[model samples]
Target: MADEAQQGQLVNDRYRLVRALGSGGMGRVWKAHDVQLDTHVAVKELLLPSGFSAPDRADLLERALREARSAARLRAHPNVVTVHDVTLVGGVPWIVMELVSGSTLQERLRVEHRLPVEEVAEVASALLRALGAAHAEGIVHRDVKPANVMLTEDGRILLADFGIALNEADDGLTGTGVVIGSMPYLSPERARGEKGGAPSDLFSLGTTLYEAVEGVSPFKRETKVGSQYAVAHASVPPPRHAGRLEPLIKGLMERDPDARLTVAGALELLAPAKPAPPPPVSPPPAFSPPAPEPPEPEPRPASAPGIRAAAAAPSESRPSTTRPAPARAASAGARIRAGGRTRRVPAPPPRRPLRGLVLFAAGAVLIAGGSYAAYQWTRTQYFVGVNDGHVAVFRGINQELGGTPLWEVETDHPEIELRYLPVYQRKQVEATITADGPDDARARAAQLALQASACAKNAGENGEDSVLTEEERLLTDRCGN
Candidate 1:
């Protein structure tokens, strides 16, 4: 015990780690052994990463501890993953959960693209069972999403990660005013800053089912405002492949939480129905229109009035359309005007071709960006690195080839660890910038850390810049020693 404690040690005098299961913006999750209990268990090491207000860190830690308590209260449910224990070691919370083996719905989506409606019905049943259990126990799994679901090897779906659960027994964990749930799956009531409940979980389940069959979120859009608007005001676009299950999906996703389908009602909806859905058409890429829809005006009709009017005339082929405009006067006059006279000008080289070409080039870029961003926003949640004038934490992973800034915080901590901050996304304000680029310290730290990781990968162990060695120094404050 003495030797083991000296070398990594057992957590809470019981669990000994065997191997890391995975790591994300949250700290590492490990497959571990419970020596005292004589069983295998899963352990999560939660960090208080640098960069959060003291109050938020405190609330976050308390809420995380509540995760164990909340899930444990629902241990009787087969679909709810069991929580065994939680321990505080060095200000980090170690969560001991049931050892379930299999892939996540998130990972499955990455491979299968979209699942059959039959399979999605099964998923919905599993999720509703878990939510029903939690709800019965007065616990709300506030952060439900595809990523939070675990599909076991033996064909069972388990609900995991209740870290931000709302426990009716205690409302203390909330009230920090931080919205901590994935935006795409966020219930409209919650998305609009209203209180959420069992109905909200059902709404999220509808989204997960939608994503499973449609391969896209019902309310997904390029920007936060657009997405929130979709969630709040815009109707969910019909799921082309949902077939008979469409009614249930829509019922669960009602904007008014009180009116959404109940867990019990959904169970009835999950019964195998008559007439299977037609074979799915290949899903369009994220940025592309789902089907041939009404065309957008070239150069984005919403923004450029001049370009829309200039481009509209020739396409409409109606001179009457031109007669109506102060919008078109300048472009027409510019094309035929003379300094002294309204003399005829040899049909000035057609400006439409040039305008169309430039518009296409510009529109192509935004469309491409929108597509990539939509995919990443809905399918893959982001990781944020904490930046305090102190040691750099695991900043490397945050620097992916193309990632979006989904959230931010104002903190004074030397370092803070948040297992899941991306879930609490604030709207993007892209207009502000400094000459140095991205006033976001996390962005800068991530870029620099990746540079360091790349250097180590190419130069080997003895390299001046090594991710592993520098990480140790940052954590230990032994830099330059």
Candidate 2:
């Protein structure tokens, strides 16, 4: 009942074809769902041309099945498309591959023109690793073209379309070595009707990189035949956009397959292009504080308790003098006045020696009195604690052992048992027991005893055990009497 199935044309009772993803000369790809896995997958159905006989359809069918096997063999590779299932429906072979969500390298080229050198290096690096994996498994990806390379939405570059590639034991490739891939990516040896090897795959990789950086295939020509000719005879044009990657590109598409860049060499060349570590962020600038206003001149001591600052410096009351400074200095030095000789007045008597002594003495006496009062109050305070299963009373809030016990009492009564009370309640009872009046302390103890006795009777009526200590249970049970 799924809307994705093509009018009851579903396959294997598992995959339901949804829509056409793409189509090539060999097969048409569909976005399909695997009912068993509950996930999306790509289904490729091989199609025979209209004029082809039944035998041609059969041959292509076998080829598609073989391509599925090839893709399945490299399942562990991250850059290689995963082959999930291969099955036949209605006498047609359908290959299920991973549903990669992204645009083809060729499509990206149409938009981006040419990739940046760093980006191309990364793409090439991924492509080389995929090829290396396939080559290691004795498989050759005969066709490595822009359309066969996929740039994923997550920034991963993948190699696709290994249909024409064959395994090591497949002797079919040795027969005349007719080029099976696109012309631009075909090496010279394969174009000249010779065999292609691992090196030939590298040449295709170089051509792929060259196009990625140059925005055009290395051996593109007007027609397929011209392209084949150029693959064998034309020179790979110098890449202006390749920059640091130009050498690797040229090395990979070398005319002689033996001279081309091997997978290892290609990896070496792209090593520097690995994305560099991100730059460290810097902390924000700190604010410079405003300078403090100059301290106000200490006010002149006006009363008995006030403290005065240093000697009153150069009073503002001095007569304003501009041109008279020299005359004043000469008169002071000669001990002479304008009309009669006179003795110079001595500098105002050195400021009173004990200016702030009285204030400091008063402050010391007040501090001594406050400290003594605090000491006496601390020694007068009392506290209660448990020691050796009995109530221990101590003097002073700090409970230091500078003195003997101030008071000790039996803690066997439920009302007085410190252990039966929560920490805060126990502290309150200790304060009440040590109240200022002995009569008040006794009254509080009697009130607490009556409350505990009532709680004990309630526990018995409810058929619940009391939480009080065993000694407290005896005291509470006798309290009502």
Candidate 3:
């Protein structure tokens, strides 16, 4: 430990490097003391090898500055490391952050291999909440592996790195055509060279949570190549150790990014709100009308001479032109009671409101069917396209007349000059839109590409930076040949 202390020289004149915290491909980090402030801090310094040119060095320095600014903006959430100051020491950028005393998630996993279900849930819940906050700010932590997460003594999870984080509407200071991030946590679209978006971060978090619960990442591989392949094609198997949380864990880890849960959706799943009760159903209305009872026939009494003459006046003269009324025979009881008794039948009861009830039922059925059809269409609609040189997504376009474009993003690919088709395919519209400058058009095109790629790949909306990559260069060069 004493010899290790000798390795790092004091930084920024005020921070005295005491001991090494950790070392990595980027540089070495140390636990240091701020003599002026009389506080403990962690100082990270870059140590890029000698072969790099001066311009490359400058770019690296700029990246470091950007990273510092990003980390400072994160503030001091319980799950985040606080950035204090940034400076140049020994010609390399150095950052001072709060000294957190805890083991990294990677170290813990290395020793214990797997966390218990309860413990995993506790840790995951906190991490996810922190992620939700970051995502709301349009920040995507490109690297979300175990190594970057620190578990403090009080059992708090702290996300440690913002080196490769991409802020929404970035200024492109990180430059074009550069890919930086780990592979295991990469979503399929990202593995296929898509930008890592909010969904991508969720994918990484899913990987982390999967490891926390299952004792292994579902995409574990001995080599980066193998891991990339698994990420792209492997069907995420059901967790061997998952107990009751199996469905959630598997769902979060779905290869189709669209199928995976969003931050809001995931929160609801893990800590569900109170469910609403179903409404009461009314009984059907009675439809049939009541029947009337049968009525008895009645007989006429003898008429007076004057009344009979008046009744027969019109017919008496001509009467006899039609036919004389015939006398009907009757039984003794009927003749006796016929003159005194008369029976009447009650009019049929008014028709019940059966037609209205039938119409209402039919309307309800139509509503339910329409809703289901819309839902199915939404599930089927997917948007995939190139953005910022890589594939990006604009999810759930099928249910919508014009789907919600997740966001407008820049594409990473170089411009393709199409000559003849512009005239044939309505170039006038394109020309009018281009008044905003080619850059904006490119940005829109990139956004469209992302949406297209998302649909084609069935990925989610959290897209990566549309920076170019070594692989894309190789593939393009090879394909062009």
Best by lDDT: 2
Worst 10 residues of 2 by lDDT: 432-441
Ranking by lDDT: 2, 1, 3
TM-score of 3: 0.52
Cα lDDT over the full model 1: 0.64
Give stretches of model 3 more than 4 Å off.
Answer: 1-8, 46-57, 169-178, 272-481
> What lDDT tens digits, residue by residue, belong to model 2 across residues 1-481?
2234463356789888877666765567888888898998888776543555566556655765676687788878889877777788887778888988666788556433555677788888888999999988788777788888987766678888776666544432332333456777888887887777788888888888888777788789899899999999988779888889888887887787777888998889767767888999999999999785444343344564333333335556876666654534342223434343354444434455585888889899999999778777766554344444333444444333357433444233433344443233344344433422233234344444444444454346325554566545433422222
* Candidate 1 deviant stretches above 4 angstroms: 1-9, 24-27, 37-39, 47-52, 169-176, 220-229, 273-481
TM-score of each: 0.52, 0.52, 0.52
Better candidate number, 2 or 3, judged by TM-score: 2
lDDT of 1 by residue, 202-255 (tens): 898898888987767777789867777777777778888887789889888887
TM-score, candidate number 2: 0.52
